[model samples]
Structure formats: C-alpha cells, structure tokens
Target: MEGDFIKINEWLKPLSWLYGCIIGFRNFLFDVGVLKSRAFDIPVISVGNITVGGTGKTPHVEYLIRLLKDRFNVAVLSRGYKRRTKGYIVADANTIMTDIGDEPFQMKQKFPKVTVAVDAKRVHGIETLMDSDKKIDVILLDDAFQHRYVKPGINILLVDYHRLIIYDKLLPAGRLREPLSGKNRADIVIITKCPDALRPMEFRVVTKAMDLFPYQDLFFTKLAYDDLKHLYNGSTRELNSIGSDEHVLLLTGIASPRQLREDLKPYVKNLTPLRFPDHHEFNDDDVQLINETFANMPSPKIVITTEKDAVRINDTKGLSKEIKDNIYSLPVKIKFLLEQEEVFNEKIISYVRKNSRNSILAKTKDDDKSKDSHNSGNGSRTISF
Candidate 1:
C-alpha cells in the first residue's frame, strides 16, 4: 500500500509542480503586503506543520496548554476541519465532536478550563475570542502554518522525522502544503516523532538538512504512549497486559498508524488494522462492520484505537454494547528529547510574558519577582529539562 502511494505520487509530479507554483505565488503575495495580515495585541502562538497530514500537532498543542494554563488564560483556535457546523463555535460542556471538529473537541475534553473555539476565518475568530467575557491572555493556533492572514507572535513549525520536508515534494507528489522554503517563517522548528535514542550526530545531520535560520530554534520531541484506557468506562490496563495469546483488532482513522501499530505488536499475538481516512467520522455501517470483524475473531480478542478516533467512535450512535465493552483507546503525550524541556518551556513563557496586552501587569515589579522565582525553579509549574 505504501509503495503504491509512492508510485501514484511520482506519477503526479506535473500536478505537484503546478500546485507548488500557485502556493508560492500566494505566499509571495502575503510577503509583499499585497495581502494584509492581522496581528493581535495578545500573544498568538501557532503550532502547525508544512505537511498536509498529522505531524503530531495536537499533542504539542496540548503540551502548550499544560505549560500556560496555570499562568495565563489560554485559548486554542482551530479551523475545525470537516466540522458539520459553519461558523465560529466555542466549545463548551455540551459541545460535541460534530460541533467543533474532533481535535478541538478532544482538547476541550482534556482541558475544560481552557477555551477551545473553531472558525474558518481566524481573524474573526480572534476578534470573537477577544470580545468574549472570558479573560483570555493568550491564543494557541492549531494547524495554521498556511493561514497567512493572521500573524502569530510565535510560529512553531513541526516536521515529522520520518517524512522530512527536505526529502519531500509539493502536494499530490508529496505531503507538503508548500515548498520547503516556507519554513523560514517559523520562529521555532520542531522535529516530531523522533527516536529517543537519536544521537547528537544524527541531530546535527537533520539540522544541516533543515538549514534553519539562526533565529529559528530547533527542538526534538518523541511521543510517549500511556496505558490503554477503556473507551466507555474509566478503567485502565497496561499496554503490555495484552499478552501474546490475545488477538488485537486495531481501528484507526488517522493519517499515520504505523507508530501505534509498532507499539502494539510486541504485546498482541495477532494484529489486524482497519484503516480509514484522517478525521473520518464513524457511521452506523462502520460500527456494524467493526462488530462483524470483532465477532469473527477468536476468543480473548479486543479492539483498540487512537485517542482521537476514540472521540468520534464514542459519539457514534447504535454502537453495540459488546464492541463498546471491548474497545480501548491509547493515549499519547509529547516528550521533548535530550533534556530540552526547560529550553522549550522558557521560550514559550518568555514570549507570553513579553507580549501580554497588560503592559502594566507584565512590567510590574511583582510580576518580575514572580518570573524570577519561576526561573529559579520555585514556581508551581516548573518544567524539568
């Protein structure tokens, strides 16, 4: 399947070239001020990738939420890809996946205190957020690398270690939304899904390949898989508990399931993957098919899916009780590699502290003292590097 995809992409090189030209022209227009970009008074940090699919954007956004929620009122803004709704919608307790899209819904679920809102027009969205009663101090823009209309204070560009932009072509022929030169706009460049054991020499090679500007801070991060949690209930099980005698049916609607599959291989006796398009909304037929597939498998079998897919799956009506009982979701978190956690955390904190709209609050002696304490590792949310 992967080889076929590569061949198809190779055959579409001409289309890719055309697409690249169009994207480049659009970017040039933005750069030359032919197209106006709006900048907000408050800090707006964007976490995005050049590629069309997942490069671990959600986890990194969640990381930022964890880092800033205690110090400031953080709000996340996304375009809400594939949402049924049409306009700006702020996620609340009653909001569903269909209302605000899967990723935003998931983030809202994880961080109820932090605001999560979606709108196609980001400038309008930022305005709406600013006008809201909630005292929002900062905004995190998810998957907005190509959103040139809103100028983010800190633009973070994520690059998948396995699928570097240096080795990729434009869309249709490759996953990139724009040319590799687009990376120059980023303030920080992160290499995501890297191996924990990656050596300094390997990092240097990747750095050389990226050819990042001196102003751009490069970092590496790996996904840390947590124990499996039941989809319907709050019960948990160790990842290794699914022994070699058990049959595993992996269901995924994400762009890349290779890492999840590899993680589950050592524990399960037989692994079968049911793949779907990214952000796929589950339907009655899909649930029925899952049931049929699960029923045919041998005893001691179970179904597993990603945390993102689990959000949509749990929302599917008419899902069988048996399937619901057997299903589990694997959670993942971002772990910065080579003890760079402090560096990343300091950079983010410094940005927010510097750009906050409350100039008096940011410049006060008390605020400076508090920041000094935080720097000295005495704060409530001290990130260890």
Candidate 2:
C-alpha cells in the first residue's frame, strides 16, 4: 500500500493469469460485437487510463477543456464516482459535490463556461447533455475507457511514465484494469508525470515497451505547479515566497502526496502534512483536527492543501471557518515534454473538427439521398446535396 510495495504484490502473481483471462474475454466480446458499444451521433472523446489510479487524468481532462473550449461548444460527462444523486445531474454554479460528484463540481468551478454532467448510466448522461442548454458540439468523457456502453469518437489512454503496462500485471497483483493488449482501443496514448530530467534512453525504453498501434500517437507530460493560493478567499501566494517567520500546515487528500511534499520542501518555512485518501470528503471532525493543529502551531501559521483538496475543504463550515480562512491550495498544470504542445493540441483539435465535419457532411448527403428517393418514387420534385 506504500513505497516499492506499490510496484508488486507477491500473493497476486498467480492471479495475474486469471485476471488476464477475464480481461481478454471482455475485450474479445467487445471486439466481436457480441458486446455492443453505443456510439452517439455527437462527438465523444474519452480520457481514461488502463491502470487503476493516480495517472493524473484530471489535469489531462482540464488540458482538453482548455485546448478545445474556444473553437467548439464543449461539455464534460462523468460517472460522478462518489456522488449521492441518481439519474442525470448537470453541474451548474448551484450544483454541489453531494448532488453531482466532486470531480464534476471541481470541473464546474474551474471551467464554468463548459457544462458538467454526471450519470451512473453514461448513455443517460449523454442524452441529458443532448437535451440541455448550451450547444454542446463535443463531449469529454472522464475516466470512461471501461464504460463501453456509450462509445467515444476518440479514446485517449494515459499510462504513467514510471508505471508502464508491460511491466505491470493485472489487478489484485498489479494496477492494470486490463492487460497491455487493451492498448488497442486508444487513439492517443500519453505517458504522464515524467521527470524533468528525462533522457533519450529513458524515452526510448518507455516508447518501446508501450507497443502501441501503428497509427497511435504517443506523448509525454509532467505535473508542473503554480504559486500556492489561499483555499477560502482565493488569495495568491508563492510556495517559496512563504516568509521564514511563517509556520505552515499542509493538508492533502489525494493518491499521491509525496510529490506535493517534496515540491514545498524548499519553499515552506515549517511544514505539517495532513494526508487523506484520494477524493476524501473532509468532514467537520477532520477540519477540527486541522483547526486544533494550526492553533497549537504558534501564532503565524498558514494552512495549505492541494487545489483538489481545497475545493472539498472549501465547503466545510462551523468551527472550521477560521482554519479554512488560513487554508490555501497549491495549483498545478500539465506541462508536456518534447516542445510538441502545439503539435499534440492541433492533432486532437484537428481530429475532432475533421470527424465532426465529416459526420455532418455524411448526414447531409444521406438526408438528400433519402429526399431524392422519396421524390423519385412519388414523381413530385427533385432534391440536391
């Protein structure tokens, strides 16, 4: 559950074959159409991973939103993982995490211009989007590679640079939800969270092990942080800018906090890490602990959490108000390697545009052909495309 043990489990080695068999059968069924994947009339691109968690899919989804927002009418559809609501719930300014799920809420907060909706049944969610306000030209499906019920136009699969699928076994033993063979479904494969000091040999080894499709595009990206900011009031402050006189408390609820801790090591004057599970919903009790900890930590203490954690903690009320007031969140964005940002950006944009345009043309041509057939049969009038 921690450290190198995360890499492999001795007891799970035997179960790998069984996991592989189940996954293989599932893929085969889908491939043969014995299991149907429903493709919508609208453009849907899925951003997901083969491995279970912590590949930085959230940032990738955000990257897509930023890349496509200007040119297209975009919307996000997710399962709303731990949400309380059932059926379809679209995230507006009024939508709460309890109602629409935390990730969608976070998406709503970050990209208010775009629509965010969630349904355990993705087809229903897509239907809601199709029937809602705002002209949604495209839909981005978050964490949806496994959700084959509603197929996407483009599948962008992410694999962590350090945790290649080839080196990993299936679940129970390893992190993969499916086998490395499942890479066949991805149109774009990204190796995320790469070190800044990547060399040619390392890149070569990764790319080789990736064993991608002939047409699949591969890219590398890393998590780069911005200045940490206050959680409650949204005031900006640099990580290293923390004065030597300032004592700080770090709070995080994510799959990985080691990276975050290391990032603030040089900058923060004094540090205290309050770790929680990934996507942890902080209650009053947790906030109380933070409050007490900060109160006892001398006079000038600053409380900090990651951006995702900040969003969750922001809603906590009661005695946590003063503690929350001092709570600041550090923001980080995905920075791609190879200076190919524009190239990758254009590739995705161009694909969506090209396919969407093609679909429109095809539909128009079909409509015209149908009209012509009707006219010819009735001996009435002509129709043209």
Candidate 3:
C-alpha cells in the first residue's frame, strides 16, 4: 500500500507542476503591479504559511494579541474558513461557531476584549472594521500570507521545522500551497514547532538552507503545552495526575497531531488516537463514535484533544454526558527558542510603532502643543528627546 501511494504521488507530479504555474503567474502579476494590492493606513501585520495545513498560525496570532493588546486596541480579521455566513460579519457575544467559523469563535471566547471579524474579501473586512465604532489601533490578518490583494505592513511567514518548504512540493503531490520561492515575499520568517533544545549548529544549518534576504528577520519558536483543562468547566490537572496506569483516547482534528501524541506518551499507559482531517466539523455520528470509543476504553481513561479541536467538539450537540465530563483540552502557546524573546519583541514592536497611525497622531498633537506655547507669549519649551 505504501509503495502504491508513492507511485500515485509520482504520477500526480505533472498536475502539481501545472498548479504551480498558475499560482506562480498570479503571484507574478501582483509582484509586478499588474494586479492592484491595496495598502491600509494603519499597521497591518499578517501571519500565515505557504503550506495548506497548520503551521501554528493561530497560536502565533494569539501571541501577537497578548504582546500588543495592553498598549493598543488590537483587531483580528480572517477569511473564516468553512463559515456558513457569506459576507463580512463581526463576532459578538451571541455569535456561534457557524457564524464566524470555529477558530474565530475560539479566539473570541479566549480574548473577549479583542475585536474579531471574518470576511471572504479581506479588504472589505478591513473597511468594515474601520467604519465601526471600535478604536482599532492595529489589525492582525490571520492565514493571509498568500492574500496579496491587501498588502500588509509586516508579512510573517511560518514554516514547520519538520516540513520545511525547501523539502516540500506544490499541491496534489505535497502540502505546499505555492512554490518554495514564495518565501521571498515574507518580511519575517519563523520556523515553528522547533525542538525545545535546538543546538546552534542546527540553527545555522536551517538558516543557511532558508537563504533569507538580509532584510528578512528569522526566528525559531516551539509549542509550549500547558496543563490540561476541562472542556466545559474551568478545572486543570497536571499531566502526571493522569496516573501511569490510565489509558488515554487521543482525539484530534488538526492537521498535525504527531508532536502532541509524543508529548502525551510518558503520562499515559497507552494511547489510542482517533485522527480526523483538519477543521473537521463533528456530526451526530461522530459523537456516537466518540461515545462508543470511550465506553470501550479501560478504567481511569480520559479523552484528550488539542485546544483548536475543543472549540468544535464543545459546540457539537448530542455528545453524551459521560463523554463531556471526561474530555479535556490541552492548551498550547508559542515560545521563542534560544533566548530570542527580546529580539523578537523588539522587532515586532518597532514595526508597529513606526507604522501606526496613532504614532503620527501623537506627533501632530505634540506639534500643536509647541505652537500653543509659542502663541501664549511664553518661550517655546525645549523638548528633550
């Protein structure tokens, strides 16, 4: 079966090449100005990847939100993949997963203070946010690296360390959405899901392989898993609390679960994973299957899933009470490796501070103050920088 799969992929290379040409042409049009790319006055930072599946985009966006929310009114805009709603829709307390997609809803639930909106047309989405009453200082575009129509102030590209674009191919044959040359478009390139203790030589090798421009900044980040939390209630448990004798039914719908599976191995006696496609919408039949699987498991067993999957599973109806009670979501965060935290923070902060409209407005206010002092018959006070 494995050999046959390889043969099939080999046969599909021609189609992948054809797909590559069409994508390459579209990018070329945008690159040379044949296709118009809109630019927003406010600082717009985009987080995305060339690959089709998860490369820790959502977590990194969340990291940015945490980094900037205290100082600026941050807003997030996404395409709301697989959402039922057609046009632009701003998330509210009443919004459901079906309204703005699961990821947006999950973000809203986690950070109620931040504004989250979804629109297929990102330009329209930005316009709507600008027209709204919310005082948005910065906009973070999620999963929009290839969305060249709206040019962002800072373009961040995420590449999975295990599935680097250098070793990947175009769609139908592999997971990449565009050619590896697309990496040139990114202003900041982050190698995501890196091992915790990456050696200096390994880092140098990856950096040399990427061959980034002098202007592009490179950073490495790894996922930091937190203690398990109950899906419904707000209870937490240590990993070792699961006991060495307990069995675990690992349930997930994300694109990559291998790392997560390995992380849970030492804690559980045995793991039985029920993997699903990325962004899978759970149905009644799926719920029934989960219930049966849980029932068949031995005593002291529990169901564990990624934080992203928890959003959809929690929304799914007809889940048995027993299943709901035992399910938990493992929280994860992006941690910059090799003590690059300060450098990463400085770069992001400097970009936003330099491009933000608020910065210009503040400068104008300072100028007005100087003029007012001059007009009031007082010598203009010298402002020390």
Q: How accurate is candidate 1 locally (lDDT)?
A: 0.89
In candidate 1, the residue pairs with backbone N, CA or C atoms under 3 Å apart (3 or more residues apart, or in different chains) clash, namely none
Tens digit of lDDT per residue, candidate 2, span 1-385?
A: 5755855576677788788898899888988999888987778999999887678888899999999899888889988877887888877777777887767888888999998888888888888888774367789999998887878888998987767788887888878898888888898999988877799899898888788879999999988888877765667877767888888888888876665676677787688787889989777787678778878887687888777776677676654555766767777889889897988988888767765644576668877877887877975544433
Model 1, residue 61: C-alpha shift (Å): 0.4
lDDT of 3 by residue, 228-305 (tens): 999989799988798877888999999888767766777877898998899999987888898898899888788899
Clashing pairs in 2: 231-328
What digit string (tens of lDDT, one per residue) describes model 1 on residues 1-385? 9999878988999999999999999999999999989998889999998997789999999999999999988999999989999989999999889989899999999999999999999999999999994478899999998899999999999998888899988888888899889999999999998876689999999999999889999999988888899998879999888877788899999997776676566677699899988999877788788888888888788888888998998778877677788899889999998899999999999888777766435456566676778788865442321
Q: Which has the higher TM-score value, candidate number 2 or candidate number 3?
A: 3
TM-score of 2: 0.86
Off by over 4 Å in 2: 1-8, 244-246, 296-300, 318-322, 357-385
**Preferred candidate (TM-score higher): 1 or 2:** 1
Residue-pair clashes per candidate: 0, 1, 0
lDDT, residue 114, model 1: 92
